[model samples]
Target: MNHFTICASKNDTHDIEEGILDTLAQGFVVEKNDSSYLLKSKGLFKRHQGAIHVIADNTDPDYFAKNMPGMMSFYHNIPFEDEQLKELVMIQISVFNTVIAVEMDKEITDEQMQLLIKLLSSIGGVGFLPDGTLLDQQGLVIVYPNGESGPSNFRPHACTKMINVQEATSAQGEARKNNTIAFLVEKGIPYVASLPQLPSVEDCAFKRQEDIAKRAVALLIAIQFACDVAQSGNIEDSREFFLNMLHKYNVQQFLTDNEKSFLQAQYPDAQYPDAQEAVSIAWQYEAYWTLIWALGFVETLEFPDDVCDCDYAIQVVSSCETFEQFYAQIAMRSKEEILDEADKIYRLHWACVNSRINGQAAPLALNESVVMERRRALFWMIGYRNEQWDTMSMDT
Candidate 1:
């Protein structure tokens, strides 16, 4: 049963909600039997008990505003407050338009027009609930204007994706489009798209921008660590340095401030709370930051010309079991290149993160003394300090 459920069919509830969470939350990449990466959210696609009663499209500007109150009441068993439900609706509306909406050529209703707005805003993070699959091609349900019956979404490739929004009496077309967008917006949930370099992950342009932000946050945290320690004159463990900086500068706070300025200066159409939530998650994702850095996944930190051998991967980075193994992937470059990377804390900071998150530098986990000694060997392969790290751009 869902940990939060009180349903009598407790087994059914568990089979639904947890199944979705277990599959989609946090991790995005899943290795296939073929050793390839599946960037799709497999969990959302998993078979489950929860049901989404796809409702009819509505056109009233008040359609979503109206029905949401009903859904809010109906899904009481789902345990979301009205405001939270409203926020989800807003996020969904802002992400994709009339998700799973069908195309109908009819007089455009206020609702259909409203739906077009949502579809245009939909990006990588939008998807159907429970099994977050594609709602529709480009994740939209097209409602064409009346007297234009078979246009099929009005877009270039929507021909194959076309489906009539609702069967109208050559008359009720407008009502249907509004109802459709409003319906999907009400029921649809926010979905964070899976990882990169996979067909399942759409909106490559947006994802690229997001990945840049994630990497920059990681580097910023590391730099803050060194800068903080240098200022206070402490040479303790990098863990202490990390905590101190988090406390002193409150990384989350600064990120919120910067993000606000960014949104205001650029992305005039973008929403705020959503942007804030994303950065907030990245702020605490120290492990990911470290992983991207050591593995050279973040382009900004990549050595100018194979300067650091961190490019090779023996196994999927996420599955690696040892910190030393992660360190070994990136052998040091020349003396100048090595210094280009940064100082002792630079190496030490990552080492500690790898060890703490995956037990890389620790001896206790190995049990075998030889294995422990071997880890110590790999840990030191990439020398201390890398000035090269500081040169990367963080403009995203």
Candidate 2:
């Protein structure tokens, strides 16, 4: 069919029809004829026609079983909270009880597409383009069953792709390496100016800036509390303090299992953290340092050859009492800047691993632990592998 189609709840048929007519009436003279609407643009020779067809008393079983699964899989790649994602799924399910198909006669103009999007938002509808691309109610791209998406005018792809880091001599890999070296040199980090790059910002799917900012704030609070628990050694008081901080920031759900384990060790009945645990948790300072830099709290992230300045790291977060206060201070670095750093760090981490395997000194004074920790943070920022914090793979 050479037209645009959208599916919404049958319950919204009246509002959908009324909304489309009212909106089109502003630019096109609209007339109702039975179930169809005919339109003629004012002061122009253009004309268009459309109709709303409601499929009553039944849901599209194929839509629920086939399409929703892929869409839900796509949502898993997004970094939103579980509850938020669940709510989005529920909204789509509600609209599926009875379907209303909206068909437009002419090729959808950008203006008309936007109008459709508004209608979808009003009733939690889903859209299907002639080219087979799917759109959620918010007009965000959701992939089809085969991992393909439509409407080339929208985002280039609906899913993120993994870069083969080992294929350094391949076409994309070569280009990435060249770009990485140039970016690092331009930004004044020239130590690894000779390393190969993995992927650029445009090559990867990134979380929204607002979401990343919130994640950074939550991470900073969690890490700071973890550090305090490590230092105090008083299990009872530190556990209360750490839990209070998590509640205060409303970030109880953001802690990874590793963080939870470390915190749990501080419980009165649990095994007390040994010297080794303290040292390991202290290394999280480097990760926290990277987060602050990404959030623009620090203007620069110095070379990761040594431990980060702990006192300064604590002070930066301690100054912000509320989550909103801390979030307000964030002027997140650009995607290009963050991706460049991630690329550089990824290569540095490989070098560190290679050195250890070969029983040689780490190249360019690189500290394997520091580089690994910073790489984890950078990779998370760029949505590398889309893995959770503790489970993030650091494959060289």
Candidate 3:
């Protein structure tokens, strides 16, 4: 059987090709043929096929993009003493923008496989097997951006397990839940086992409490303005009211792209928002709620089985006149507290996504939109991936 490996890289095609040649030079005589390479073993007897075809291109790896969250979740389960390295791998995986295809005419030997992995890894590449296993250049070692690597115990076909929450019998449902929890726990991710658990405050890297408070206030003003303009059909008075609030809070610089776009669409000659746009703008309330919770405005974020109370949400922000007053009322939760919630929501969000992919109702009464928006807020609060507010990825 022919063997194939898909690799993702930050390097261009030429550099990756050179890397392949350099890596294989010790074991084989390599000849470059355009994008392909031909190899002959230096040993007396060849162990496998002598020819390899490579195709490198500048394109997003669709499989990686679609399954990234699941892959990262898998990696996150692996234990790493260096939290920074763990995070670095996540960030590097998120930004890989190129793909390389390595093909052999026959199944590769174990030795040949290691060579291929080494070549890819030398160029800061990630490998994906046909069975959905992700690997570093050193076979199973998870490589860091700075050339350090850690052993990985990730198993193949782990991502293919699926459960239909609505169809299973009570016994089967319990089994599935137990299996899922066990799997996560064995992988060193215990946060998903129960109600969200906070890490120690010392372990968290949090934005300044005051900064979080300011952001919450700014989001509140922007989202509320959007709600009003949507309710008033984008009238001049509504625009004036929003502008006045922005001036009052001096939060113009903090508006997210979505908020700015919604406002811009309401310019004097612009059209009123369509139903989709209006709903999107309104849903920012959930994100706003999460920020307030982080800022200690909300007592606790109840399970997201329902949308947050709009009237109560409005009351929370309106109670404070200025940003300073809102900051004053803030008893900002510890970074550990917010991250714990974020981690729990992440797993819950994954279940929701898994259900959708399987054509079933969202499991555990999860409101998919609420879960997603809440995650978006929590992720932003913790600066997950250091992404901008509008571009932040809520990878399950």
Candidate 4:
């Protein structure tokens, strides 16, 4: 008996077998005696003369891709999506998978990669998801992070995260407005110049780079921490925190009426709801600015003085191909075993940035599996054993 691998466009078992037959009928013979590639189709595949094994991705892809190391065959189909310069686009289409990418030994710069993805999207070769991945019309993510499903029914769309804390500070609001445009200017992404300033607190939301979704889990923690601090911290703490953070981020020009009134009040006697809202707002003001600045900084590839050393981070992330490998090494360690939460988060940030820095163009993120796993583990580690922060509420 021998095993074979089917590389199908679809993610179904029956379709894969039929695809194998079709491919075989087309006179494309399997070079490797032990393995084969099949596109997906419906109906049972005619049994071969001898016993053979077949496997697929979705469940089987990751397992075989990793475990069946010695029996590996790389298949990459380059979809021609960018038609900007017809001939220029063809030049890129010739380089499909990593093996070819590596074989060509051609290094594309980060700027070039960004432009290429945009070009591909224009040509219908890819779609940009709010999740920050590039998908084809068939819903297969052309460029995705590590350990994720490539095909889906859901179409991609531009994503914007609205920071709608009613008590938000001026800095938070402007981060939604000014800094976003600033970032566009910084990154050279074209946008209309006279864009209106964001109106509602909800308007403070902006689109993010796809790789930043690792924060999907961490966001719950931040929200909870804000809620807790809001409930427990004194008015002085809230007022002082917001005031300090707003000034530090220099967003005082954009302060909200509520935030302004609260800071100006002589004897800050805000009610419970108002107080909590204030704390949450203040935290968001600072947090959003910091996040925006950090993300923008990463685009420059120059580590901010406030951030860790890039050389050290590059050294740390060099070994990780996927976030899976990176997590396997760190997940076992207790909170004390590693650096603080900031360090861990930053390391993940670096891991996400690794491919982009290496000229891989589209920065893929950590898979949802790893993101959810980290979320669960961090919840327990943070001692949030209570049901309050369980899956349901946190997910919202």
Top TM-score model = 3
Mark the regions of model 4 whose C-alpha exceeds 4 Å error after superposition.
Answer: 1-13, 26-57, 60-184, 187-305, 308-396
TM-score of decoy 3: 0.59
Judge candidate 3 at residue 232 and give its lDDT: 59
lDDT of 4 by residue, 218-280 (tens): 332233334544666565566566555444434354443544554546553554445555454
**What does candidate 3's lDDT look like per residue over 132-211, in tens digits?**
45575556755433334547642221111111111223443344455546644664433323222222334334567766
* Highest-scoring model, lDDT: 3
RMSD of each: 24.1, 18.1, 11.3, 21.2
lDDT of 1 by residue, 1-396 (tens): 111100010111223233223442333332322211222322354422221111212322243433332322222223223334334433333212122222222333343333333432321222232212112223442221111122123222111111121111222222333333343245341111100011111111111323333333433454343343334333244435554534443333433344333322322233222333334332323323333444444444421111223223213332443333434455323332222232222222222233334334432222222222122212222311111221211100
Candidate 2 has an lDDT of 0.61
Residue-level lDDT for 29 in candidate 1: 32
lDDT of 2 by residue, 177-247 (tens): 67766754665442222233455455666767666656665666556655665676666677678778878
Angstrom error at residue 290, model 2? 1.1
Better of 1 and 2 by TM-score: 2
Q: Which residue pairs of candidate 2 clash?
A: 133-150, 177-197
> What's the true lDDT of residue 85 in model 2?
36
Which residue pairs of candidate 4 clash?
15-40, 15-41, 57-61, 145-365
Model 1 regions more than 4 Å off: 1-96, 99-218, 222-282, 290-396
The lDDT values for all models are: 0.28, 0.61, 0.63, 0.33
| Model 1 worst lDDT run, 10 consecutive residues | 2-11
* Residue-pair clashes, model 3: 0
